[model samples]
Target: MSRRVRLALLTPALLGLGGLFAWAIAGLPEFGDYRGPYGYVLNQIVVPLRHSTNVVMGTTFDVRGLDTMGEEFILYAAVVGVTLLLRDESGAGRVERRTRRARSDTVRLLGVLMIGVGLLVGLWLVAFGYITPGGGFPGGVVLAGAIVVLYLVGSHRDYGPFRNEHALDPFEGLGAGGYVITGLAALALGLQFLTNLFGYGKAGTLLSAGSIGILNAASGIAVTVAMLLLFAEFLETYVVPLEPEDVGS
Candidate 1:
């Protein structure tokens, strides 16, 4: 069978299955009562746990932390694969100095300022993720955006002094390890996996949500470092190729 034929058949089959499921659900109770134990749990426990309108976000970082760990690992693996595939070849010659573009000093200064502010805000978001609306993943992305802004404005030579890439692996490793340890601590206490071992604290305090806060912090650190490392590595491998012209040929 041709690929087109297979896809045509598959599409109809999926549509048929979807229709069947819809019909089956349509036949179920229309006016249900929330009185049972399961219903009570749903009302009291499950609903309260989801603090965000973003369903996937709430589930990944809050309700299903273990699963989120696996998801993070998947992302990490993808980054590693990209790094490997895009690495500079051994045969590639060293980069030589070249007449570089004249970067705008004003823009560079603004980028540095933005980087400083973004870093502080991102850190706050990560640290207070459990208490507030923001989270580690979002915070990490914010930091990455700051890095991009810095790169866009600064001279390529400026990145060399930063060594942001070198710091990433160790920091990420620490964050992952911290998350795992936090989980294990909960388990050791005879609580469920990734349980909120620490007090939820005051409803509005920075210390609210206990272990969840710690987990968010770990995740934030990991994601930030990983993204920065990946971006820097990508630039080195693909955009900044190891050609003599790249340096000074």
Candidate 2:
């Protein structure tokens, strides 16, 4: 069909869906109402069941773990898609040339400092997620930002402990796969998928909230690796002429 005809047919369907979505949202409980059914359930059940004071953490990594797993995979797939789409296929060899402009020593030093601070903070957030506020997603973003800072400081090949880009590929895979494995273990034991199969330590403690800490750590690792790889792909990108003479034989 022609473009105009396709648009005409799609417009009404799109509008109908949007209207339904708006209607559904309008029917939801009032904003900031702690007394709402969902909030009440989390307050009453999730904390006791998960044996963690952090109800949000319990909800995210335990009660609704399957949903979170799907979301993580969505992000993983999106990054992979972007990387594949932006890949350079030219067979011409790479050439590096020094430019006249250079970053100031102060700027480079600042970047180095930020890398240290970011990594520490990121790990802290991930480790304490079950007991405290933040979790894997935010912690992973912080760690990725640290790697980016290292890249900015002209450390193109390595970032502190992570000396090679190839090693990060597996880290991302492990993070995404670890979550599924944890869930499957629960299923194998006759419990629901993603259930907290391990012991729930004392409430408000680091060891509390069985499986949540592991999930958080896994997610953090995966996210950090994926983001770093994405950054490396963009940073190392180059273009070459399509002429036969310029192309490799």
Candidate 3:
């Protein structure tokens, strides 16, 4: 059969399959209760995190830390795949680089100011994850994006002192490694895997919530930097010309 015919035939079958699956799932309980044996333990042990700013870390690191480790490996595999697929061709011919028109000094100054403010806000969110409505993922991503914006609008030559590739990669690796090691250490200390053997401090403080905050920070850094690096690689590949000549003469 022709490819068009195959797609046409498959489309309805796929739609029907999806409809049936959705129908089946629609019959499930809306939400599981916390009165069951497992829920009883989990609620006593874990529900506190639902109110946490670092909810991902609270659930993943303190409650399901081992699973988080596996998830990190999955992310590692994905990054590796991207790196392999998007390897830079150093030997590619030089492209012309048109000098980007300089912006007004006021515009440049405002961009720098925003970058600083954004970075500060992002760090505040990350640092206060244990006590507020913000968390590591949001904070780190905002910080990374703020820095990238600074790169785009404020400066071309230095890109606001960020290494972009070197520092972020190591930081992400360390974050992933720290999460895994923390879990393993907990296990070795005779606790269940990923158990929060450490004390959970008072609920509304910076130092409370045990390891969840740290895990949130780590995962946030990893995710943010990975995204930034991916964007940077894309810019280097399709947008930013390597050599000055590549731009129209």
Report lDDT (Cα) of residue 151, candidate 1.
65
Candidate 3 lDDT over 84-111, as tens digits, reads 7777668463342333523588877787
lDDT of 1: 0.69
Q: Please give the ranking of all candidate structures by TM-score, highest first, separated by commas.
A: 2, 3, 1
Q: Which candidate number would show the highest lDDT if scored against the true structure?
A: 2
Off by over 4 Å in 1: 1-59, 89-102, 161-165, 239-249
Instruction: Pick the TM-score winner.
Output: 2
Compared with the true structure, what per-residue lDDT tens digits does model 1 show for residues 130-224? 55568888898897777766666665665553335555678878777788888888899998878767765554556555566677878887788
Candidate 3, residue 82: Cα displacement in angstroms equals: 1.6
Clashing pairs in 2: none
RMSD of each: 5.5, 5.8, 4.5
The CA lDDT at 10 in model 3 is 100
Better of 1 and 3 by TM-score: 3
In model 1, the clashing pairs are 96-247, 96-248, 97-247, 97-248, 98-247
Q: Point out where model 3 deviates above 4 Å.
A: 1-7, 25-44, 47-56, 94-110, 160-164, 187-193, 239-249
lDDT of 2 by residue, 1-249 (tens): 999999999999999999999999898877875455887878799778888677887888988888889988988997788778876678345443222212598988887899899999998888887778888988898989987777567533344345345777788889999999999999999988888878998888888888988888888888888787777666556432354542332
Task: Assess each prediction's global lDDT (C-alpha) against the native.
Answer: 0.69, 0.78, 0.67
Ten contiguous residues with the weakest lDDT in model 1:
93-102
